[model samples]
Target: MFYTTIFVIVPPFFLWRKKMKTEHLLEFVNVSMAFDDRQLFQNFNLTVDSNEVVGLTGQSGSGKSTLLRIAVDLVTPQSGEVYALDRPVKDWDPRELRRNVILVLQESQMFPNTVRDNLTWGLKIHGESIDDEALLKILEEVQLSSLDLDDDAFNLSGGEKQRIAIARAMMMNPKALLLDEPTAALDTESAIAVEEVLDELIKTHQIGILIVTHNVEQARRFTSRVVDIHAGSG
Candidate 1:
């Protein structure tokens, strides 16, 4: 009788452990946030997992961007829990956490240096380096072979800068990538090029993606699941 009880209890316990290990890369549980007099969302639930692309869509003030901010601790929610890499968001250092889970904004921020410095800066943050050959390959992947590594990053157009920002994030090899209107500023050809790179990341690295897009067609094409924050439920 004792052995039978032990066998039944042990299997379920181990199964629970396995389930926990597969938790979302970033998860918002009953999260709530507000700014000034406006309430952004309540009881919001979202899960971003490895090997999956999740789309986030809503109107301008629906707080889609804020959800991304909260994941990396940029903005704190008034209430609810946030988990990153299966641990509570507060458990990890903000900078270290951001390194593993990177966010690329719509409007890119340029470093005051050459494009080489911009791309290498990602590796430098982790005390690693990439040679010129590999750097050029990454550039070519993003359709910027024409731009020299020595070219000033600040001089690039808004759309070009966006691509650079994405390439920079790729250098870091984050476990999860949050992109906010990533291709909004690009032309049709450039947009498709960026999508190809993202698809590669998904297939090769099993990286989770949380993409916030206004274009319904883009959400359908890029994501396996879509969540509207205003609807306020999974």
Candidate 2:
């Protein structure tokens, strides 16, 4: 009888450890979506492993960005389920969920204040206590050291603004990041800079990322897995 119990318990522990060691960080089970009765998707499944970069690609209006919104819980699906960090999204509190799952929209909004305020906004909203040193580190990571803390974000370049947006998402130490056309407005240099920072973050912090972009090269450059969305199940 003791041997039987031991065998059963040991296998379960080993399985748990195996799961923990792997990334399988985010999952979607038969996800579907619709807007105003227009069907966007049906029975779609996707999984993102930790430190894995996934690219979401499709033609214009193919619901690529909408898919990320659903994953981040900014929008609800008509059917199916989304789980982040292995927990049902609905089971987690909304405020706490926002902290864990950060999303950068196609057009990021900057507060009418200093660069410091914009970077710290999400952290403060999530009740995270961070010091100046930590803030500086994150800003430097995203190559925004040139922007003074007191300087108005209103005047920053498009690339600088986007980098700041990325920094805000990173400050939360999130399990995953949802990026929608993060570099759409940047020059070549700035776009490369943003991509480099993202690559560094993936290697150093093991943060899982789902980026929405129409640029096939960007998708090829960053993502380990590619999810292609086509028109009407094509």
What lDDT would candidate 2 get against the real structure? 0.80
Model 1 C-alpha lDDT per residue in residues 61-174, reported as the tens digit of each score: 989999999999999999999999888888899878898899999888999799999999978877998899988987876778999999999999877888898789877878
Clashes of each: 0, 0
Encode model 2's per-residue lDDT on 144-175: one tens digit a residue. 87767788998888888888888888888887
Off by over 4 Å in 2: 1-23, 231-234
For residue 80, model 1's alpha carbon misses the true position, in angstroms, by 0.9
The list of candidate 1 runs beyond 4 A from truth reads 1-16
Query: Highest lDDT among the candidates is held by which one?
Result: 1
What TM-score, over all chains together, does every model reach? 0.86, 0.87
- List CA RMSD, all candidates: 3.4, 3.0
lDDT of each: 0.87, 0.80
Clashing pairs in 1: none
